[model samples]
Target: MAETILALEGATKRFGGVPAVRAMDLTVERGTITGFLGPNGAGKTTSLRMSLGIILPDEGRARLFGKAPNARTLDRVGFLPEERGIYKKMVAEDAVTFFGRLKGMPAGKARQRAGEMLERVGLGDARKKKIKEMSKGMAQKVQIAAALVHDPEFIILDEPFSGLDPVNQKVLESMIRAENQAGKTILFSTHVMEHAERLCDRIVLIAKGRKVFDGTVNEALGTVPRRVLIETGEGPDAAPVLAAHGAVTDDGMTGEGTHRYTLDLAPGSDAQDALKALVDAGVRLARFEPVRAHLHEAFVHLVESAEREPA
Candidate 1:
């Protein structure tokens, strides 16, 4: 069995008599990338803080490496909080080296690793530049380098992708995959689903201070019905054939003499069977493909469903 790196059992926290995170349970396996996902104000940060022992949980337990969080355990962990902070007056390399030293590294070794990490993150040219002199994206990369310089066994990041442009986001994604390949366990929180979809081996979803879903990506997508996009030359005639299998939404006839329809496959309906049925009906198919359910769709559905449930 794989080792459990982090575990939260019935973990709960509140601020000023209001629950920030309620009875949350989560476990991250070693060498896996786990995404702690939820929208803003969904208790993701609260839960993470509790797990890190930054804030004491009001109930239940939070454990790191089979023991309660402490300085020794934390030394083996690297964290990038949701709120970004660095010494604005400090040079980029100095800032990273400082973080490493705080995690108990000697100054010379910390500075050496800082240089290597900066180069890896594409900030080699900016190493001697002050944090205030760098652009937002460049500064963000510096902060990430700081978190990773120590090469901790487990890395936790809270909303690391926020405020980054598409290009920088992709850069960070590559960095994350590199870390995982190095055999470090990673857990990150994000409101954006695309990052989790692409990076997470497992996902934990929370909403309204509670966990709504926790499972593999494929399992989460399985909660919603499957859909297929089909384009055929049979125009209106294609409607009846698709409707016979499942609810069909007309995407309208294209200018190229092709009719498009989106079919929400009914329970027990297979995409292959639907395609075969269309072909059997003599519909000249131009395109037939499954529309895979995305993490965003699954998240929204789960949150909305939880909201509708009785107290």
Candidate 2:
């Protein structure tokens, strides 16, 4: 069995009589990229802080590497907080090396590692430039390199892709993949569904300070109903036939000559059954394809379902 790298059992935190996170149970196994997903103010940062022992949890427990997080265990962890900061006067390479040294690397080795990391992150040319002279994306990449310079076994990144353009986001995604491929246990927090969808082997979703879902991408997708797009010939409308097989419209049908309709399948309802119904009814089908459920849809469904649960 794979070793559990991190575990939080009933971890809870509160501020001023209000809960920030409540009874959260999460476990990250070794060598897996786990995406901690939630919107802003959803307690992602707080939970991470607690896991790192930066703040004491109001209740329950958080363990890193099967023991309480502290200086010893933390040396094996690399963390990039949501807030980014670096010494304005410090050279990029120097800043990265400084952090590596703090993580217990020898000064000479830290400097060597920092140079290699900066080059790998596409900042080789800017290694001698002061951090204040770099662009926002460039500075962010420097911080990321600094976090990894010590070669920690585990990595935690909070909103690492935030404030990055699409191109830079893709760059960060590639970096994350490289780290995972290097056998590092990575846990990254993000509100963006696309990042988690494309990169994570598992995802844990929190909403309103409560854990709403936890599983693989496929399992998370299974939480929401599937959708199928159907386009029928003008001769016969397929909407009515589909509606009988679990098709629902948020708004009542309004458009005339509408040959295209999207059907949401309820639990246990299969797209094949809908197609068979359409064929048996002699509906002229122009197109039939199952629309795969996206991570965004699954996330929304989970949040909405949690919201609807009784207090």
Per-model TM-score, in order, reads: 0.92, 0.94
Model 1 per-residue lDDT tens digits across residues 1-311? 99999999999898999988999999999999999998899999989999999998999999999999999999999999988889999999999999999999999999999999999989999899999998888888899999999999999999998778898899899989999999999999999999999999999998889889999999999998799998998533788888877899999888888988899998888999888888888989999999879989999889889878763
Q: How close is candidate 2 to the true structure, as a TM-score?
A: 0.94
Q: When superposed on Cα atoms, how far off is each prediction in RMSD?
A: 2.1, 2.0
What lDDT is reached at residue 43 by model 2? 93
Q: Candidate 2, 295: how far from true, in Å? A: 0.8
Model 1 CA deviation exceeding 4 Å by range: 232-237, 257-259, 279-287
**Cα lDDT for residue 70, candidate 2:** 90
Query: Which residues of candidate 2, in runs, are more than 4 Å off?
Result: 250-258
